[model samples]
Target: MSAELSGTEPNRTEPNGAELNGAQLDLALAELGEGSERWASTTLAARADLLARTGACVAAEAKRWVTAASRAKGLHKSSPLIGEEWLTGPYGVLTSLTALRRTLRAIDGGHSTLASRRFGRAPDGRVTVAVLPLNRYDGLLLHGFRAEAWLRPGVTAAQARDRAGLGQLTPTTNGGVGLVLGAGNISSIAPLDVLYELVAHNRVSILKLNPTFDGLLPVYRAAFAPLIEAGLLRIVTGGADVGGYLAHHPGISHVHITGSAATHDAIVFGGSRTDAPRFTKPISSELGGVSPIIVLPGRWSARDLRYQAEHVATMRLHNGGYNCIAGQVLVLSATWPQKAAFLEAVAVALAAAPTRRAWYPGSDGRMRAARTAYPAARLLPGGRLLVAVADSATPAASWSTDDILTTEYFAPVLGVVELQGSGQAYLDAAVETVNRDFLGTLGANILGLPSSIRRLGPGFEQAMARLRYGTIAINAWTGVGFLSAAAPWGAFPGHTMDNVQSGIGVVHNALLLDDVERTVVRGPFRPFPRSIAHGEWALLPKPPWFVSARSGALTARLLTEFAARPSARKLPRILAAAFRA
Candidate 1:
C-alpha cells in the first residue's frame, strides 16, 4: 500500500496495466509529441535552468530514493550494499543532469566547451579524445585513471569541434514523442535514458517503468517534476499490455529501451513467428552481452597476481554480477606458465569476498543453466561465484561451444577459456577470439602487466585498435567508461537493426558527438604508493564499491554530496567514511 511499507517487503507485486489502455496511451503520446516541438525551440538558458532544478531535486530526495531501492532489493538498512543503491540510483541521475546542464550553459554562451584533450590518432585514422580528468576534482579522485573516446574515422578535429553540441547545432522544428522502456535492475537507468532522449534527440519522452521497480514511480516523479511541468517528460507504470500499446501507438515517433535483446526483438518483430510486427517506430536499445576479459601472458610478481585477482573478482561480483558490463568470460594464455596460478588466485579472491543477495530477477534460473551446462563448474561456498574452466585442448567441447560464450549469464559466473600463444602472438590471437566469439560488442577488458604492454609496444596498441567492442578498458573494468559522462557508451558505431549486437546507439555522451566509435579507459598497473595494495595508503581507503566494505552506504552518500558540491572541508569526512569500511 503505502510507499514506506512497500520498502520493507522482500518483493512487491507488479503493477497491473488494465487501465493503461489505448485511449490513455494515445493521449499521453499526443501530449508528448506536442511538447517536443516546444522543447526543441526552448532557449538553452531555460533548458539549463530546468536541468539544474531537477539535479537539486534529486539530491534532496537522495536518501529516500536509495532507501526505496535498497528495500526492494532486500538490502538491510545497514547493509554495505546500500551504497550501491546510492551510487546507481540518485547519484547517477544527478550526475547526468548536472553534466547536461553544464553543457547547455556552455552552448548558450556561443561556444561549446568539453573536458576533452586530443590523444593523437589511431592507426585507423580515428582521433582519440581523452575525456577523463574531467576537472580538478576528478583528477584528484580518480588519480591515474584516464578515459578516451575515439571518434569515427574521416572526421577532422575541426569537424568534431564544430559538431560537439550537435543537438544544439542542428535544431529541428519537427520534433516528436519518444517512448522509453526503462530497465529494472539499476534504479537510475530509467531516468537517465529519459534525459538522453530529451537532451540528445530533442524528443519529449514518456518513460514506462519496468514492472519490477514500478514502486519507485513516486520518487521518479518528484525528481523529474520540472520536466513533467514543462510537458517534456512523463513517468508512468504498467505491464505488458501498456508497453505493447505504447510501442505500436501511431503517435509515438521513436522508441528507446534498456533491456534484453529478446525484448528488443519482440518489440520490433512481434513476439511469435506468426504474429505481425508490434512496433514499426524507430527503435534504439542498450542490451546485455557476454562481455569478456583478456589476460595477457606476463611475468607478474606475487603482489601483481593478488592485486589483479582482486580487481577481476571485483569486476565479476559487482552488483551480484547482474551488470550488463560485468566480466562474463576470462580469456587467458593457455601456454603461459602462470595460467593455473592466476586462475587459483582469482578463485581465492572470489572465495574471500563477501556474498551478496541474489536479488535480480531470473538469477536462479540463469545460475542453474550455467551449472547444468558445465557440470564440473565450481560453485564457491557462499553460492555466489561460479567458476567453469574450459579445456584448452578440446576447442569443440561443450564447455567451449556451450551457451557460456554466447549467452549473458546475468549471474555470478565467470567462464575461463585459455588460448594458445605467449607474447605478441597471444595478444593478436586473443583480440581475434574476442572479436569473433564474444556475444555482444558492448564492453570488454584487457589486463596485462606494464612491462608486457611495453614489450608488445605497437602490437599492443594495434590489438586495442582491432577490438570491435564499443568500450574497451585496459587494466580497468569497462564500467568506468559507462560512468564517464563525456565518453559515449554504446556498441560499436556501425550496427543495423537487423543484427544489433549490443543495442543500436550510444548514450551519456554529454558532448553530443554523433560520430563516436568507442571509448577506451586505461588505469595504472598498480595504484599509487605501490604498497597501497597491502592496505597502506591513508588517503585512498579500500574502494567503497567493494562488496566486502562495511561503510559503503555512508561512503557513497559522502561521495555523492562531495561531487555535487566539492569542498576541501568535506574531503576529510569522505576519507573518514571510506576508512571506516
Candidate 2:
C-alpha cells in the first residue's frame, strides 16, 4: 500500500542482490582492471559495433523491453507502448552511427565531414546537433532540428579541452568498479550513463536498479548482453541496504547517481553524521532540482500564448511529474500582456490532462508538503496531485527559499513567480535566482518569443552568459534537450572540482571529461503541441506509435534498421500509421 501524506516512512523494498554480499561485488570490480587502457585499446569502430548490436537486440525485442520496463515501474501496459516511433523514438541512432562511421572513415582517410552544418554548428563552431523524433511533423516544427550525435571529434570537444578546463586524458592506475544507481522513472538514463563510462572515461559500471523497478533486470541484462560480454558493464538490483553496501564496498571506484540530494548526502556523508562517508571513492551525482522555465515575452499572437502555456504545463504533467528535470519554476515578465492568458491556458491544459498513476512510495508525503505550503494551490481531482503555485509578489522577499524552492518535490508541483520589471531585469533576476537560490543544477528551460529576445537585446545575451546550468534549453523544456544526446548533457559551464551543481561533467553526446560551463543558448520555437513535453507524447495516453522520437528507444530502432537493412518500402506504412495515430 502507498504511504500516508502527513506521516509515513519512505517505502523501502529489498529485492535480490541487496547486500552486494560476495561474488557480485568482486566480479564487477575484477571487470574494471586497468580502466582506460582496456577502453582505449578497444577502437571506436569496435565500440560502435557493440552498441549497434545492442541497439539491434533492443529493437528486435522492443515490445518485451517496453512491457518489462513499464511493468517494473508499475505503469499500465498501455503507457510507453512499443511502436515505430516509440520503438524507434526520435534520436536516429542509425544516423548517429552513420555520422560516426563517416567520421571514422574520414579519420582513416585524413579528412572529416564533421564541420558541416547538416549536423549542427554552435556559436563556437562546435559540432552540435539536435535530436528529435523521427516523425515529419516534429521535423518541420523544429526548424533547426538535428539528430542524436555520436562521435569523439567535434568543435565542442576542442573548446571543452581548451577553455572548458577539461583535464588531460588520464588513464586509471588501478581500475575500481563503479556503481550506477539508475533512476526508475526514465528507461534510457541507465543505459546512457553506462555507455558514457565505457566509451568516454573508460570505466566498468555495475548498474544498480532503483527499488521501484527492480523486476526488469532480466530484460535489460539480455538487451545489454554485449556490454556484459565486453566486461564493461553489469546490472544489479535491491533497495537502500544494497545501495549502501555497494557504496561502502572498497572494490567500488566512483559512483554516479540520478536521484535526490538527500540520497547523495546520505551516501556521501553516511546515513548518520558519526558514521564514515559511505564510499571513500570519488562520487559524482546529478541530483533532482527545481528546474526553472523562463518565458521571454515576444511578438505575440494569442495562438502563441495558448500554444506555449500548454507546452509549459505538459512538462510538469509528464510522468505524473516524476522527472528530476521537470519544470518547476515559471519565470515571466508581469508587464507582458500575454502572461495572464498563458497562465489560463496552462490551467486549462492541466484540467484537460489525464491523471497518472502515483505509485512511488512516498509520493503522498511530497504532495502534501507542497500543498501545506501553498493553500490555494489547485489540486487536480484524479490519480496524482498536480499542485500549481502562482506567485505575483515583486520584492523577492515574498519568495522563501524553502523546500518548494530549494528542494525537488519529485511530484506534480508547478510554481510560477512573476517578476515585475523590464526584460533585462527579469533575465538578471532569473539568472541570480538560479545561481544563488536553487540547490540543484541538473537542467533548466527558457520559453522566449523572438520579440522578447529582440527587446532584451544585450541583456538577454548577458543573462544567457550568467545562467549556470548544464542543459540551458532556450525555448523548449529542458527535458527534451537533455534527452537529445546530440547536445552535451552535464552541469552548466564553470563547474569544476569544487563546484558541481550542474554535475561534475558531461555524460551523453558521447562527451566524457568535458569542461563545459553555462550552456547558454536559444530556442526560436515558442511552444510545440506534438512534443513529449510532459513525457506523454502527442496528446496520447500511451506514447505515440512513433515512440522512438523520444531518445533511447528511437535511437535504438534507427540504429538497428541502419545496421540491418530493413525494406525501405515499409517506411511509408510506418510513418503513415504513426502520424495518423
Candidate 3:
C-alpha cells in the first residue's frame, strides 16, 4: 500500500544495523563469490532482462520507499518537505535504471548510443558529450538545463565510443567479487553502485549499507530483488566492524566506496601508518568535500539580488543540508559594489526558508563546532548558521588554515568568503581560490548573469577548464550532476591513496565512456515566466528540486511514475504541476 495515499506509514524504529555473525557473513560473501564468474558470462540479453524486471520491482516499491525515507528524515507524510525524499530517493534510482536500460538495449541492437548523440569540442579540442535532453521528456522537464560529460584530453570521438560498455560486448572472464560501501546520506547511491558494478564492470557485488540508512534496508531489498534472486548481489547491514571485515576479506576482489576519506584510508591501511601496511585490491571511491558556490559579480536590481540570494539559500539548504555536494562556502567578489546587498539578501532568504528537523545524526554537533570556530556565526530564523569571513586578496591560505574553510560540515552551516576582484580577474581568482583551498574535489558551482558571462567570454571557459573539481555546475547546483545518470560523478582524477583528497574514480557514467575527466552542467540564471522576460528560454519555474516550490511533492511523484513507465499522456500533469511552482 502507498503510505502517502493511504495516510498511513509503517512502524518505524531508530536507525540500527542488522549485523550478521561471522558464519552468516561468510555464507553471504561466499555465495556472491561463487556467483561472480557466472555473472561475468551472463549474456547481455540476460542482463538487460534483469534490469527490466528490476525497474518493475522498483516501481512497485517506490511509494513505500519514498514514504519510509521521508519519515526517517522527520517529514510527516503530508509535509511538502517530503518532496525532497521522493526526488532524491526512488526517483533517482528509477531514472538511473531507465537510462542504463536504454544504453544496454542500444548495445544489444549493435550500436553505440554515444555515437548517435550530439558531441562538441572544447576550446582545447577535448570532446564533450551531451548527457541531458536525452529525449523530449528531458527537454520538456528540465527545459533550460544541459549537461555534458567532458572526456579527458586526447580522447577521440571514435575511441570514446569504442571504449564504452566495456564488458557488455565481450564479458570479462575473470573471477571477482566487489564490495560496495554505500553512502548513508542518499538512498539511491547504494543500489546505483550495485548496478554499476554488475553491468559496467561485470562483477558480482555485496552492498554494505551504512548504519544511518538501516531503515531503508528492507526498501532496498524489495526494489533490487532481481539481483538478489539471481545470486549476483548480497545486501548487508552493519557497523564499521563488519565493513572492515568485508573490505579486508581476501575473497573480495575489488572495493567501491561512497564515503569519507578517513574511512577509505582506514580500510586501505588498516588504520596504521606506522607499519605502512598496504591492502592492494582495486578500489574506487566518491568521497565528498567542501564545495564552494562561487557568485560572480554583476550589475543587478533588488529582484535579481533576491532571486540569486534565494538560489544560494536553496543550494545550501536543500536536503536539510545533508547532501555531499551541498554548497558550504559562498565565494563572492570583494570589489563588486553589490556584494554587501547580495549578502544581506542571502541572510533574509535563509531566514525565511522553512525549518526542517536536523534529522542527520551529529548535525547539531557539527553546527555547534562551526559556530564555535567563528564568533561572527549567527543563527537565522530557520536555524541556519551563516559565518562571515573578512575579504582578502588571498583568502585561501589564511582561511584554509582554519578548519572552518577546510572541513566539510554536512549540515545547514554556510560560510561566506570574499575575494578581492571582479569581472575576469575575479573569475580567475575565485577559481584559483576554490581549487587551492577547498578540501575535496567533488563539486563546485559558479553563478553569473548573462551580461557578466558574455563580457568575460573566453576567460570563463579557460577558468572552467582549469577547475580541478569533478563536477562543475554553472548557475545550477552540482546536485543536478549527481541526479543525472548520464553524468560521470566522482572526484577529479589523479589523487594518490596517501593524499586521497576526495578519493578516486567516477560512477554513474551511463554512457560508459572511458577516461572521463568531469561533468559540466549549465542552467539558466532564472526560471520560467521570469526567464522569458530575461530572454533565457528555460520553461521550468521553481524547479521541483527547490525547497520553495509549491508543487514539489506532486511534481516529484509524477516524475517518479514517468521515469518508471513514461508515456506521452503523463507529460501534461507533470508540466501542469511544474507550472504551478
Candidate 4:
C-alpha cells in the first residue's frame, strides 16, 4: 500500500495544506449526496424537466463556454481549430439529452412497460442504469442506445411502480464525494467527469483541476454554475502536492482520473515517495495509449487517397499530437498494391498542414525516442515531420518489437508498419497482436475499401468482438468515436478496480455508469468523385475539398443549422455551399 495513504493518515491532516476543510467538503456532500433514492422515486417526467433545463442552459451559454475553452487550451479563437472543437466538444452531452427526451416521450405515449423498453447490459453481465445527471442534455444523447440494448421486461403507464433501478432516474445510493483529477490536454474531460459522477454513481463531485489549465478554473466554475448552485459540485486547483493530499484524504469517497498511465499507477500502486501502493478506495481512470490506425489497402481513386491522407495528418496534428485518440501506428495491408503511393500522398498532406505546438507533457522526450529508432524519419526540416514511415524493414521491422509500437510516443511521430497477407488475415492477425501485445486498450482505427469490408464480413464481426480495446473506429479514424457521443467510451472489456487502463467505467453515454466494455463500429462509403481518391493527390489544396479550412467552417455551420431543423428542401443549398467552400 502507498505510504501516503496507509499508516498515520486516518483522522490526521494530509501532507499538503488544506484549502477545503473537512467540514466544507462534508457540507457539500451532505447536500448533494442525500437525495439519490429520493430521485429514483421521482417520476421520469420530473427527471426530464431537470434535463431540459440543463440543455437550455448549455445551448444558451454555448458561445461563451466554447470561447473560454479555446482560450484556456491556447487555441486561436477564430481558427477552424476552435470552431471544430466547439461543434464536437459538448456533443456527447447534448446528444445524451436528446436521447433522454425521446425515451420520455415514448413513456408519455404509454410505452412505459419495462418489457416494452430496452435494457443496457455490461460486458460482465451486470444490468444497471443508475444515472447521475450532469445536465438535461446527458440523457437526451445516450438514451437511444441504452433503450435499444436494455429496458426492463415490463411497463407501467403511471410512474413505474416497480421499475428496474438505474435508468434515466437518478440512483438512491449516495456514493459520497469523489475526487476528480482532470486531464491537462482537454478541457471537456473535467466537465464530463463531473457529469459521470453526478449521473452514474450518485456522488458529489470535488474536481481537482489539472495545473496545466488552472487559469481556466473560474470559467469552468461559471459554466457549471447550475451544479455549484445546487451544491453538488466544487472546484479546487493546484499541483502535485494538492492532488496527492486529496487522493489520500478520507473525505474523498472515490477517485476518478484522466491522465497518464504513469500518473495513474503512481496514484493507485504507489511510486516514488509513496512507494507502498496503499489507497484502499475505489478509483476509476482513463490512461493514455498509442492508438493504432490500420489502413487496409484497396482499389480507389486519387481523391479517396488524398482524403484519407489528409485525415491522417489532421488526426496527428490535432492538439499537436497530444490526444489519446491520435493515430499512432499506421498499419498497412500488404495485399493492396497502392500502399507505396498512399504513403507518398500522406507526406504531401503533412507537409501542407500547419505545424502545431508540441504542448503535452513528455512530448519532447517521446518524439526524440521515436526519431532515434527511425533516423530516416523526416523531421520536417523546418517544421514537424510531414510524414514518417520506418524505412527498410527487412522482414523484421526494428520498430515492431521496440517502444514505437508498445509505448505511446504521444507526439507528431507517425509510425508505419507493413503486414503481408489477405485483408481478413492481416486484420485478424493485427487485432490479435495489438490486443495481446500493446500497452493500452484505449482506441484503434481501421481504414479499408467497401469491397474488402464486405469480403471480411463475418470475420470482421468476429474480429471486432475479439478486440480487447475500448473504442474501435472502422474506415474512419478513431477521433470520430470520441466525437460521437452515440457510442460509449472506455476499454472494450473494462477491467476490475485492481487494474484499469482505458478506465474502470464508461462515462460518455451517461448510462450504465459501471465498468463498461463497449465496442463502436462504423463504416463510410465513398461518394461519387471522392476527393480522397488514390491517384488524384496533387490537386488537394483546390476548392471542393473538405480538407480545406474554409470547407470545415462551412460544414460546421451547415450542420449546426441542419441540426437546428432537418429539412429536405435545405439539403441542396447546404450541399452547394459545401461544394463552394
Candidate 5:
C-alpha cells in the first residue's frame, strides 16, 4: 500500500499530450506576475491579519490534513503515528504562520525586533541570538530547550540592529514572479516556503506540487485561499515536465526549491554538460546531505549512556529516517571506555522502537545499495534499522572514505565510525572529518556532558566555529532549527549555483537578517526530575511527535489548537493526553 506501489492514478494529468497543463502553468505565472505589485504594497498590519486568518484556516482543517497525509503514507486511521502527520504536517505549518504573524504585528507597531535575545559572540565576531523560549508559553511547554542563530562572521551589533526589518525595508515598486518547487516529503514545506517568498521577499509565488503528493492540492488551495483570492499565490500540480516548463518560463524572476542537489543543478545549469543553461533566473535551494553526530569522549554513568542512546535513535528513526537533517553517521572516540556500552544501548533502543513503512520513493533501492556497500551491516528485527560499524587504520579503508559518507541514505540506517584520540584531540579530529569528508554543509550534532564540554571549554567553542554546517545542535537534534520559524535555516554561507553543496540561500528567518552563517541550538543532556538514563521518573512525557506514542494523534491535535490560541483551561487535558502516551 506504499505510495510507489499504489495503483491510484495521479490527481493531475501527465504532460504527454495535455495542452491544458501548459495553459494552466501559463495562467498561474501570469496571475502571479500581475499581482506582485499589489501584494508588495500591502501594509504590514494588513499582511499580519491575512497571515493570522490563514493560520486559523489551517487549524480548523487539521483533521482533514492529517487524514490525507496518513492515507498517502499508507498508515491506518488508528495508527499511533497519525500524530506524526498532524505535527509535521499542519501543526508545523501553523507554527510558522503564527510566528510570522507575530513578527509582522511587531513591525506594524514600530517595534522591528526579533523574538530571540542576543546571547554571546564567537571569537570570529559572529553574534549568537538565542531564538527559543520565545515567550512564557514556550518556556512552559518546552523546558530546558534553547536554540540560537549565529550571524555570519564580521556582522557587528550595529549591523545586526540595522538589519532587523531588512525584508520590509523598502516596498517593492515593481514586484516580480517567483517559482516555488515544493518538497514531497514534508507537507508543510510548500506552504511555508510560499509564505517566505510572499511576506519576506516581496514576491508573488507559483507553487508547483510534487507529483507524489499532488492529492493535497485541494487541501492547500483551501488553506491558502486568502492568498489565492488576492492573486498573489497559485498552486499547480504535475511532474518534472511541468517543473521544467515553469522554471524556464520568462515570467519567473527567481526560484526556490526543496529537493535533491541533482535537481538544483539540472535547473540552474543545463541537463547535459555541453548544453548551455536554459534558465538563468537566480535560484535558492535547501537540499539533502550526509549529517553527522559527534559524541565527545567523557566519563559517563549508565544513565548518560541510556539517555543518549535513545536520543541518537530518535534522531535517526524519526520520519522513517527520511529527514534531510537525520543523523547519518555517529562519530565516536575510539579510546573512550564506554563506547561499547553506548553502542549496545543504542542498539537496544532501536530494536525496541516501533517500525514505520519505508514510504518514500527509491528508499528500498537506496537501502539495498547501502547494504551492498557495507556487507557487515546488522539488520535489526523487522528490517527497520540498519547498524553498521566501520573500523580501519587507513583513510581508504575507513567509513569516512566510503561513498556512504557522502551519500544520504534517507532511511533508518546509521553508520558508526570511531576515530583515534581523546578529549580535545578527538573533538578536533571529529570536526575535521565531518567538515572535509561529509558531502553537504547542512547540519551536525554534538553530544557531551557539562564536564566534558567544560574540559574542552575554549577548544569546544573553537570547534563549533570550525564546523561548516548551516545548523549545529549540541546535545539536541538539529531538526529543532528546521522547525524554529524564527531561525534562519539553510546551508552555510557562500555557495554558488555551480557548486551548490547544501544550498545557496536561507529561509524561515523571521528576523529578516540577510547575512546568516548558521544556527546553533543546545539542550541539556538531562533535564529536571529523574533522568531516563538512570531508569528514574522523567519530568517530561515522551514527545507526542514520536511515532511510538499511542496518543500521538490526540496529543498533536490538542497541542496545535493550544498553539493557535493558548488557554490555561486546556493545559490539564493536553498534559493528561501526553502522559497517556
Candidate 6:
C-alpha cells in the first residue's frame, strides 16, 4: 500500500494528526520483534487473562477515548453526535475484546466455541453460523438484530470447527512481528487490527497509527497498556513515510493495513521503487469500496416507509459518511408502486437528519466530482447529496457511470440506481447489477418486509447466494457487521495482487472461523411502539446509531459501560437510555 492513506489532506479534514521519526520507529519495531516469541508461546489461559485486563483498561479509559475521538472529528464535547464516537470508538473495541476473551476461554477449557452458537443451513446447502445474539447480554443489548456467516459453498459445520483456530495448534511456530498500518477514519480500527494480529495469528504487533488518528494515541496507549507493558504490542504514530518504512522493515514478518486500494497497491507493488515488491511479506487489508443497499419492492405500511427512510438516511450519514460500509449506492426496483413516495420520504428524512461537518480529507474534491456527475444533485445542509438517476427505470441507465456510483466517495454522497423489474425478477436483476457494476466486494444490504421475503422463500436465499460480497445484510446496515467481532470483516476472499478490489483477508473475526463466504446481518423493519402494533415484537426503538437519535450520547455511554463490564443491574438503565433514543 502507499505510505499515505485516503483523507490525508489535513488542510481539509483535521489538524490534529501526528507523526513519528525514523529513530523511534526503528526502536519500536525492534521491541515488538523481541517479544514475538514470548507472545506466540503464551498459554491460552494467560492470553485470556491478558484480554480480560485489556477490557478493564479500556473501561477505565473509555470516557477519555470517546472525548479525544470527538475532538479529532470536529464534534464538540457537548454534541449529541459524540454518541457516534462512543459507539464506534470505545464501545466497539470493548465488545471485540470481550468476544476474543471468550474465544480464548473456550479453547482453554477444551470446549467448542460454537457449541452454544446458532447454526443453520442455507438453501444452497452451505453452513451458516449465527454471529449475533452472541449471548444474553448481546441479545438484550441489540434486541431484534441478528447476523450469520454463510460459509463458502459446500462447507459443513464440522469443517468450520475443524478449520478454526489455525495457529492455536502450534502457536510458537506462528510467531511473527505483524506490522499494522491503521485506518484513519474509525478510531477502533487501529486497536481492533492490533487485537486480531495478536489473538487470531499469534503475532506480536507494531501498530503505526494513521496520521489522522495521531491525537488519540494517548487514549489508545492507556486502553492497551497491558499488551504494551507485556511487550506484545508497540504503538507508533506517523503519516505515509513512517508507515512505508515500517511496512518494509527487516523485522516485520507480515503486514496488515486498513486504508485505500491505492495504499494497498503501492506497498505490494513497490510504489516509486520500480513497479515491484522490494520485500515480500504476507499483507492483508480491509479497503473501503462502493457498497450497495438493495431494497426489494414490498407491500409496506406508511410507518415502514418512514422508518425505513430514516434507516437509509442513517446508513448514508452515520459518522458523516466516512465509514467504509456506509450505504453508498441505493438500489431499488423502479416498478415498485411506492417508488416515488419512498424516494420523497428518503429526501425528507435525509434533510431532517442532524448536520455534521464533512470532516474527512479531500471531501471538497469528492463533493465537487459528485456535483459534476449529477448537475441536478440536491445539495443538502452538510455537503450531502440526494443524487438523481438519469433514467429511473432501466437496466442500461447511464446514471450508473458516475464516479459516485463506481468509486468510494468516502463522504456524504448517496446515488440511487433503479432496476426495471418487480418481485423475483427485481431481486435477480438487482443482484446482477451490483455484482457486475459495483467497484468493491466488501459489503451489500437487502431491505424488504417479512412477507416479501417469505414470498420469495428459497428464491430469496438463492439471490443472497448469488450476490458476491464479503458481508451481506438483510434489512440492516452492513456497518453492524463491522461492529460485531464474531463476523469476519474484509473483502470477499478471492483477490490477487494484480486486482485487489477491496484488498485481501479478513479481521475482527473473534470466533476465528475460516472458509467464510459472507456474513448476513438482519434487523427489524420497524422499531418499538410501531413494531408492537405491527406484531413484529422486536424491542428496537429509534436505534442510538441513527444520526438523528436524540439521546444517542447518553445511550451509547451506558451501552459502552455495560459492554466493558456487563451487569444485570445495569440492564434497566441501559434499556431506559436506549428506548429514550
Q: How many backbone clashes can be found in candidate 6?
A: 5
Query: Which candidate would rank higher by lDDT, 2 or 4?
Result: 4
TM-score of each: 0.92, 0.78, 0.95, 0.78, 0.92, 0.94
Ranking under TM-score, best-scoring first? 3, 6, 5, 1, 4, 2
Candidates 2 and 6 compared: the better one by lDDT is: 6
Per-residue lDDT over 89-165 for candidate 3, one digit per residue giving the tens place of the 0 to 100 score: 88888888888888888888889968678888876888999998777789988999999988999999998888887
lDDT of each: 0.78, 0.56, 0.83, 0.59, 0.78, 0.83
Number of clashing pairs per prediction, in order: 0, 32, 0, 63, 1, 5
Highest lDDT against the true fold, candidate: 3
| Order of the predicted models by lDDT, top scorer first | 3, 6, 1, 5, 4, 2
RMSD (CA, Å), candidate 5 to true, equals: 4.4
lDDT computed for candidate 1: 0.78
Lowest lDDT sum, 10 consecutive residues, model 1, at 3-12
- Model 1 lDDT tens row, 1-581: 32111211122233543355456666777777778878877888998998988888888778888888877778788767788888788877776787788788877888755534555687678787767766666676666678888888887777777788866665554548888999888898888888888888888899989877877877888878889888898777766666766776667789898988877776776654334444557888999798899998888888788878888887888877889898988899878888888988888888877676788889999888888877888878667545556646856344545587889888889888878778998888888877787788999999987777888898888888899999999988887787776778888867766676789888888777768889999877666556354333323445666666678789889878876666889887887787776
Which stretches of candidate 5 lie above 4 Å from their native place?
1-20, 274-278, 385-389, 392-399, 531-541, 547-551, 579-581
Off by over 4 Å in 4: 1-44, 100-170, 272-277, 386-400, 494-499, 511-516, 527-549, 557-581
- State model 2's lDDT: 0.56
Error of 3 at 355 (Å): 1.1
C-alpha RMSD (angstroms) for model 2: 7.0
Better of 4 and 6 by lDDT: 6
Q: Residue 433 lDDT in model 6?
A: 83
Clashing pairs in 1: none
